[model samples]
Target: SAKHSDLCERRNIYADEKSSLESELDKNLVQRKNELEMTLIDARIMESETLVENESFDLELIDKRIASFRQLLEEKDAKIDELVKQQTDQKELLDKLRAAEDKQMDIINVEAKTSRKIAIKLETIEKKHNECLRKLSKMGTIPSDCDNNYHNMSLKDEYLELQKCKHKLSKMPSVNQKALDQLTEGREKGRILQLEKREIKAGYESIQRLIETLEHQKYEKIQVTYKSVSKFFVEIFQRLVPEGKAFIDMVYKDSADSGSAGSQASGSHASQESQSSGGISGAGLTPTFAQIDNFIGVRIRVAFTGKTVVKEMNQLSGGQKSIVALAFIFAIQRCDPPPFYLFDEVDQALDPFYRKALADLIKEMSRSSQFISTTFRPELLGSAQKFFGVKFAKRVMILENICVKLISDCNMN
Candidate 1:
């Protein structure tokens, strides 16, 4: 029994051990199985992700292809639109071309009608030319039949016949005597007109002669008047230059009626003292109107020292001439007093003594007429009734009648 119990206990322990081993083995197998299942699940998940990535990639490729197709479609649509615009333009051009072709056809038709009319006109012109050529040919055949001498004789005979008929008509009596009388009166009127024309020509010649005579008379009068004025000038000139004599000379431009050309007239006068010395003398007689003509164009000659010259009166020295002119003017004024007299710078050339004399003369002349003079010399101040001082400041002071007054000034005070 003890052996049997030991055997049972060993069997029990073995069984228990077997059972525990089996359990451990089973748990390990279950864990390995679960791990294998998880590995399979991960592989499935990786495969599903790869499939999804491939689907997304395919979708992206399809989208790219769709975009490319859309672009191509847009290009095609643009090409179609361009083609449609070109077709519309081509239609419009074709319509204009048709209209132009129709207009050209109308022009061509009109040109054809014009060409036909021109052809008809050419035919008519050719017919007329042919007729003219035939007429010219006929004329050419009939030209040289009559001799020149015979033709001239025939013309002379006709002229003689006409003259004989005219003679007969002139010799025949008029049907009405009144008509003959009228013809005679007409001839008398023509004769009178001819006489009047001759009279008019004679009158024109007479008028021309009269004009020439009048011009000659005017020249003579001028010469005579100039001689008188020259005589007065000579007296003044001689007084100016005590050493020489002066005379005025007349010059003529053309021939006088007496047929003398380039003639000159001169009248000379000298002082009494100069004449007594025989250095200068007058011709001893006054010239008549006829003798004055001989001296009408004489030139004045002035001799100073040994030199003889012809010079204008204005060429004389101012002071010398002024004295002479003043003397002459005083003489004239003494003879006939003027209503008023003005002396401008008359004392400019006078010496003190002459100035005094001139002042006295002016005062004497003032009794008959008004005398005004301007002087800068202090000696002349005593002779003035009033004194006026002109200042550089544009002021004028009048000391006239010893009542000093300001004539003009900028400042009132």
Candidate 2:
């Protein structure tokens, strides 16, 4: 029984050891399960964070695209505004063109009416001139006959008066003293009648010369009047264009091809002189229609040295034409001087040296006339006695900067 009890105790000890080993195994298993569960929860949290990150990145991209689209819309709106402005400008230009066309048409109609009126007036003048010529011819013929008849009658009357004086002397001879007195009276009467006849002859000759002189003077006056008008045009044309030649042609009635034919005839005599001296004195004379028989026509020629040959006024460059036109206007002003002159952009085409020369010329001219010019160049400003600059938001300001610089320089000196 003691051996059985010892065996039982050993058995109990082994069973207890086994039970503790099982409990430790179960605890390790529980711990491992709890660790797996915690790892799974951590993995889920990481997946959720990654998803949130992707969503935020997508939202940022969408915001950028919207901003780009808004910029494109603004650009398109700006282009539309520019196009609208161009369309409005084109409409205004079209309106102006239509108005100009209408004005040109009105000018054409007025010119046509004026031409018709001039034609009618010319016809009337021609008719009146012909009637006057007819009347003059008739008067000339009648006056010549009347003068001859008057001369014959004066001679007959003188002869009758001499015979009457002789008869009176014979009757007075009965009284010797009376006869002598009568003879002396008759001699004195004869001398007086001779003197009267001589005076009458002289009066007739003087009257004829006076008529001839009056007709010659009338012809000369007409020629001079026409010449004066032509000279005026020539002077005007000369002033209008620098280094240009101009002339006027006078008209006459007697010849059909008078201008060319007469010029050729005069040229034959004029060829002895140089062409630079111009044509013969009378070579320019030409006959035209009755109305404009005394009228004068003008011709002008301009020579440009450099660049392409410009045959017409329109062919010249803007600056060149302006200069030429200004020269002409200045020449006109010289004919009738003005109180002063104002010039703007007048030296646009001139170079520095030429500009200086022009300023000097202006200064020289200013002795007789006052001149004012506006310019942006420093060289041009130097020409002025007093310089004023137009400043933004400020009234005409005298250029004090230059003066300040000059004073500083003087102080340094």
Which candidate tops TM-score?
1
lDDT of each: 0.62, 0.60
Query: CA RMSD for every model?
Result: 23.1, 40.4
Clashes (N, CA, C under 3 Å) per candidate: 10, 1
TM-score of each: 0.33, 0.29
Tell me the tens digit of each residue's lDDT in model 2 across 1-413: 99999999999999999999889878997788889899989989998999999999999999999999999999999999999999999999999999999999999999999999999999999999999888555433233465565575667785686578568867875545344446768999999999999999999999999977886676676555445544543344344333344333343343333655565455334332312334112344433233353444422223443232323345566755654465456545665679888988677876565456556656656788777777644445545555444555456544432454543444345
Candidate with the greatest lDDT versus the true structure: 1
Candidate 1 lDDT by residue in tens digits, 296-379 = 454344443324443334565665456656755654454445898877778898777666656665665567788776676644
What residue runs in model 1 are displaced by over 4 Å at the alpha carbon? 1-246, 253-315, 324-338, 353-369, 378-413
Per-residue error at 244 for model 2, in Å?
A: 8.0
Error of 2 at 285 (Å): 6.5
Estimate candidate 1's alpha-carbon lDDT, on a 0 to 1 scale.
0.62
